[model samples]
Target: MTTPLTPHITTPITADLLRGALDLEQTAHGVLPHRLPARARAQCADGQLAMAESQPSGVRLVFRTRATAVELETLPTKRVYVGAPPRPDGVYDLLVDGRPAGSATVTGGSTLTVDMTTGTAEHRPGPPGTLRFTGLSAGVKDIEIWLPHNETTELVALRTDAPVGPVPDRGRKVWLHHGSSISQGSDAASPTTTWPALAASLAGVELINLGLGGGALLDPFTARALRDTPADLISLKIGINLVNTDLMRLRAFTPAVHGFLDTLREGHPTTPILVVSPILCPIHEDTPGPSAPDFSDLSDPGDPSDLSAGRLRFRAAGDPAERATGKLTLNVIRDELARLVEQRSADDPNLRHLDGRELYGEADFAELPLPDRLHPDAAAHRRIGERFAALAFTAGGAFAPEAA
Candidate 1:
């Protein structure tokens, strides 16, 4: 540890201290964690993918220390959309000795102003802020600071009342998952509360979440990234992003999915890879996507500040007739993914197909309707996580120890 920075010892943030990120880029201010590697990033220039990969959904700082109090210095980029209701400050969850403890948020750092209507964004730099956690039981314990799932954060420093060091890996399997915003934690309460995080917790596995919001298009670079990642179990939550973006049709979609799986298979021939279709999204279930924000629900359009009065909603604008022209819908993609998985599994026994609806289907929607008709709410995240654990981590399941 470096010399005391005032009353606490400053532990230099290093790659060894980070979990769930694929690469760490040293910046002038701090170390920036990235879900995609440098080579993969260079291969694609999509802005949404760039921002999503940098937000560190499943990333966290892990270490061992005896400190009763700790402070994390970070440079976080908080996204703000013009004319929309104010978003809550990014949350950093604390875990001590493998249990929920406390949470904090950095007050200020940088701002990313976005014009959602125009699909453009601007970044304004600011000084770093600190996240402080005080009062803990005495003696040594493992510590984890889960980064904000929605904020792009740069790790600056870790200061504690006592010395800190990286903890030894506990030899748990690592599960790598990639999906859309719902998986990126669109409206989840906190970083650790996201469905994937919760599922990983329940399943007792380390997690590497690449659930990029609006970034799960079947891109070659992303396939390469997934191929390079080392994982014991892998899953691709396909269909939602493809439908929402309307980037491809049946002719292209079929081969792209195959190529993506082929790339991953190249890396780990026998790794259990689960192909999950889109969850129960009623709007896009049969009707196609290219979903757009539906501000029509607003009681007072003039007073955009009342956005909270009515939740932000989305509507599928694609014509059902387009489905005849090879346009993809959630239901259509589900059928294709299922058929593809069944055919591929004949030769690749480790591969499996899971209907996303099984995790959150019609009954689930009745119990916990998606708040925005797009993303799952916190309760839904918990339900999906619990259900996934029961289905995938139980005996004879794809991720089960014996099954592997």
Candidate 2:
């Protein structure tokens, strides 16, 4: 439970206070319906507050900030629609600074109106999307937003004329996670129920999600991001994507993982970092993804021959041993991650490793087919969340509560 508190609200919206975007980041032409501009960040993780596990119930969350002005800008010029899909039916409590400003009900796929004439907006008859607030003070101290239930909230875009401060929530430990789409909640029911979101909720710890959808290619930029960020608890889920995407060769795959970890160690000298191998996705379990366009798409069954240059292809009758003998299989990734941890453990005890299959395996897949045959469904999210809570937040773990 969050502590109920009020924040100052005297400041007014100003030109210098707005903090989202100065110019439109990009045009939505040719992009998928649910896709957003590159500059637009998923709103689910902002202003996050996590408590220490075992802390007394009734934790308080207060965002003390003022707004100068808020702009609910639109794209496509004329009568435009910013579609927010996958939201549930509910009346949200939109707080300005700390008081109730307005309410918006989000209907998945419905376009919430962003009237250009008046900054006032209304919902599309379902659930709510982004709740834009404007005219905020330049020095708005704490701008608190709360969710009535554990439902997922997706904020599309916000431009405020205020300088938002650090989140007021406090915790001794921070949890960092890096992975592919499943970790990014692709095909999951909603943003908050994504396995990582579920896991974070149960553990009661701060989270910095680096789960990139279709973008976790073991790129150096990603490793540098993880290496530089500060954290108390960290976990990296690998393998499944490597197999599904066939993004790297065996020679390049192993060294990339090592380099990613080595760089992360530079910033977090003693932080506990856990590396998790991919969970079981039978489609690529025994087969290297064979460097093809995503075959997981049931609708298209993309061309196997055109996956891209230097990509590996999964053999239709691919077997685990055969897959391991060639490219980056789940088992192969697991072994590599374990070896990385073992080698690093010679000098660092804070680094840890977990097999993702332990959280969800072939059996779970029988009951719940990942919507895309890659990402988990809602029930699986719950299962993974509970398992992670038990493993990562137990006594002596980073988020464990203090002894009473």
TM-score of each: 0.95, 0.60
In order of listing, the candidates' clash counts read 0, 49
The predictions' CA RMSDs to the true structure, in order, are 2.9, 12.0
lDDT of 2 by residue, 1-404 (tens): 83322332223322232211111222232111111222322322221111011010111123444555443322211112222122344333344544455544443433345432343455443322333444444564555333212222333333454434445445546677777666765445544456776677567665556565555566565566566556677788777656765667678887888888788878877777777788877777656664332334333335432222212133323345655356667667777778887897888777667778878887888887665456676788788878777766787543344310
Across residues 282-336, which tens digit of lDDT does each residue of candidate 1 receive? 9999888798887664667553324455356788989999999999999999999
Model 2, CA-based lDDT: 0.51
The 10-residue segment with the lowest total lDDT in model 1: 302-311
* Deviation (Å) of 234 in candidate 2: 1.7
* Model 1 regions more than 4 Å off: 1-7, 297-310
TM-score of 2: 0.60
